[model samples]
Target: MRRNGNSDRLSPIRVYEWMPVEALNTLLKQLEKEKRSLENQVKYSALRLEQESKDYHKTSRERCTYLAERSQVSGSYQVSKRQQMDQLPRMKENLVKTGRCNSVNQKTMNAMRGPVKKISRSNHLPKLNL
Candidate 1:
């Protein structure tokens, strides 16, 4: 090969010999920097995934607790409703008995007041013939 000062035409062996020590050192430093950057990215991705998993589990637990509490409250409400329904007939019977007692009380009150009669004004005045 002729010594043409063009770098593109240099043979592999000549290129290796021609590369400066400083250039090789800079390339190695850049490769190490890139490797460290890749490692940090992988570590960050792993931490993020772990955090997401924890959040998901926490929300799932909260959802379960909320559902359990809601079910308990609804169950109590249903039991109270059933108890009210069961007592409906008794309540109606008590009302009917009270109505009958009220009729008797009203008769006694009227009896105490005495029988009502119509009175005329002439009955209070003495009879005088003109």
Candidate 2:
């Protein structure tokens, strides 16, 4: 690769030629510890994701079942409503042909109830002249 003119500006200036072995060993140990911690964190995150996926699937199934049951109930209600609508005209026609709405029930109810007695005002108070 050809060096760009800006590479000189980005490059770090060398202060020392080599690093000490003790310092290098300590740095390696720190990197190893960091690697182990990062690996543990990744494993924990993976398990959490798996649990969440399972819960999502279970909840999805339950929701689908609930929706299906709701649809079935609504469908039955709609069918019953349609049947009632279909029967309404026939019921009205029957009522008209039979002449059943001609106030006969009211007359019968009045006959069954008979008559009520009237109260007399002359029995309680006598005639007085002023």
Candidate 3:
């Protein structure tokens, strides 16, 4: 019963018959190794990101504190300067009328002496309190 080359005949090999349990186990182990490696990389990246975030927050907080302090100091300085400017004309008038130097006018005349004197005078009680 020799068939022609064009005749339809079933092959002897079965598709599912090649399944080996050892080969399947090895493939699963390889997949697990890859998953573990990927997980480690993700963990490392997350840790680095967290550390960077903490550092950024710390730096931002320090900057905010510094700016706040600077603003406070500048505001005080501007207020003191404005007060001195307002009193300058009156002090000059007093000096012209009195012809003798007074303590208040002396302090006003030396307004640019230093911040220490200003701060000390600000904290001290006036002569009226004595």
lDDT of 1 by residue, 6-116 (tens): 755666658657789998788789999999999999999999999999999999999999999999999999999999999988887787678643454454455767644
- Provide the lDDT at 19 for model 1: 85
Instruction: Report the error of model 2 at residue 35, Å.
Output: 0.4
- List TM-scores for all candidates, in order: 0.57, 0.58, 0.50
- For model 3 the local lDDT of residue 110 reads 51
Per-residue accuracy of model 2 over 50-123 as CA lDDT, tens digit each: 99999999999999999999999999999999999999988977876796753545444546666434568888
Model 2 stretches astray by more than 4 angstroms: 1-17, 97-130
Arranged by TM-score, best first: 2, 1, 3
Alpha carbon deviation, residue 119, candidate 2 (Å): 26
Instruction: Compare candidates 1 and 2 on lDDT and give the better one.
Output: 1
Task: Name the weakest run of 10 consecutive residues (lDDT summed) in model 2.
Answer: 8-17
Ranked by lDDT, top first: 1, 2, 3
lDDT of 3: 0.79
Those runs of model 3 whose alpha carbons end farther than 4 Å from true positions after fitting are: 1-19, 91-130
**Model 2 vs. true fold: TM:** 0.58
Pick the winner on lDDT between candidates 1 and 3. 1
Error of 2 at 53 (Å): 0.8
